[model samples]
Target: MHASVKMQFDAIANDYDRQRKQLIPCFDEFYGMAVSLVECEPSSKVLDLGSGTGLFAGLVMQKYPDIHLTLMDLSDSMLDGARARFSRTDRVQYIVGDYSEYAFSGQYDAVISSLSIHHLTHPDKQRLFHTVYRLLRSGGIFVNADQVQGHTPAADAYYRKQWLEAIHRSGLTQEAIDSSIERRKLDINATLSDQIGWLEAAGFTDVDCMYKYLDFAVFYGKKA
Candidate 1:
């Protein structure tokens, strides 16, 4: 992750969770579908890349309580929220570092990320997919719940317009909406189709976009 992006997230660490539902129009269904697609046993090992505040992992834990989880991110302050969220549990672990550059310790049954990864440059996103593929055990799942760019210029413009409309109707204060818009300037999103292709190129099977609404999408794939 870039230092500027890390600093940006650090500044919002305190209010991230509160702002999430307001910023994402399809909050519940977006995350709920991602968690549902995770095929893991109670004892499965999971790694959450860019696990801001552990929100997504928290959802996964609700479904698989005994799964051991490692939350990795570049911002310490963001991880602090996650630490507090899972403070009482020994099954959760934290690593403060860039997910794109970190050396993962072991293979996992499932690797997940949310509202992250889009910050990476296109080349970095491709490399990260390869890394995630290598980090997963055979038959393991990899799911990313994040935003994507449209395939065409006009479609991209429409995506932004639609997002602006939804945010305005989300009941957020003007100041909150402005802050969210500013934060999105750091996004380096790829098209949904490109990401699916990248996953397949990285040797993942059953690669597909499991869910999508405007620009937000949940991509799912598995190692053969």
Candidate 2:
């Protein structure tokens, strides 16, 4: 992650959890679908990339109480929020580092990320997919709930228009909305089809997008 991007997230770390539902119109369904697609045993070891504030990992932990998780992110301030969230628990471990360059050790039964991977350039996203494939144990799954680009220019316009309308109606303060918009400048989203292709090329099976609402999507593949 770029230093500016990390700084942006660090600045918003305190307000991120409260603002997430408002920023994302389909917040419940988007995250619920991603959690549903994660199939693992109760004691499965899981890894989360770009795990800002541990929101997604918290959801996964709720579903599998015994699952051990390693959460990685680029900003210490964001990780501080995660530390607070899981303060009394030993099952969760927090690592402050860039997921793209981090040297992951040991195999994982499941890997998940939400609303973070889009910050990487398209080529980096493809390379990260390959790294995730290599890090997973056989039959393990990788699930990503993030944003995607529309296939056509008109479709892209519609996506942006709908997002703007939804956020305006979400009752957030104008200042908050402006900050969100500024942060979005770092996004480098890929098309859903292209992401699925990358996952398949990285040696995943049954690669498919499980859900989508405009630019928001939940996609995953199983290592085979």
Candidate 3:
């Protein structure tokens, strides 16, 4: 991860919910889809990589209270928010680390991440697949909800305008969208095909793009 982007997230931590409320519907749908994809038994052990504020983890917990989750993130402040959010439960464990390099030795039934990893460079993204694959038990899945690069110029324009309209309708100014575009470079997202290839290379089978809306996408693959 870029030091600058990590710092940006640190600064945005307090205001993130206030500034990005428009992302709720999209995030809600994404998490729902990812959670639906999880093939968990009553005693399944899941790992949520890059878990922020425990929002998705809370949903998963509500749905399957018996399932266990280990949430990991890079920012301590995000971990604090997550700890507070999941305060009622003792089923969750938190870790502060970079998944790009950290080696989690234990096996998990499912691995997940949401709206994270775009900040990571492409190579690191690929390495993440290998890590997830290694961490999962056989037949386990990795579900990731995130942004994607467009397939063509028209698609790029389409997603760009859709995102702009979403932001504008949410009361965020044009300058805010433009600023995010510049600082985050989200529109140039890595292609879905390449990411799928990376997962396959990491020894996953049955890879699929489970859901998508323009730049927003959810994908998962079963580890063999």
TM-scores for every predicted model: 0.97, 0.98, 0.89
lDDT (Cα, tens digit) per residue for candidate 3, span 6-101: 565665566565565564437667767977887688878989987876766767777788989999888777778788878888888999878787
In candidate 2 the C-alpha lDDT for residue 144 amounts to: 98
lDDT of each: 0.93, 0.94, 0.78
Best by lDDT: 2
Ranking by TM-score: 2, 1, 3
Clashes in model 1: which pairs? none
Order of candidates by lDDT, top first? Answer: 2, 1, 3
Model 2: colliding residue pairs: none
Q: Please, what are the lDDT tens digits per residue for candidate 1 over residues 1-224?
A: 49989999999999999989988988999998999999888999999999989999999999998999999999999999999999989999889999888877789999999999999999999999999999999999999999999999998999899889998998889988898898999999999989999999999999999999989999999999
- Residue 13 of model 1 has an lDDT of 96
Give the poorly placed runs of model 1, Cα more than 4 Å off.
none
Lowest-scoring 10 consecutive residues by lDDT in candidate 3? 179-188
The total number of steric clashes, by the backbone 3 Å criterion, in model 2 comes to 0
Q: How far does residue 50 in candidate 1 sit from its true spot (Å)?
A: 0.3
Better of 2 and 3 by lDDT: 2
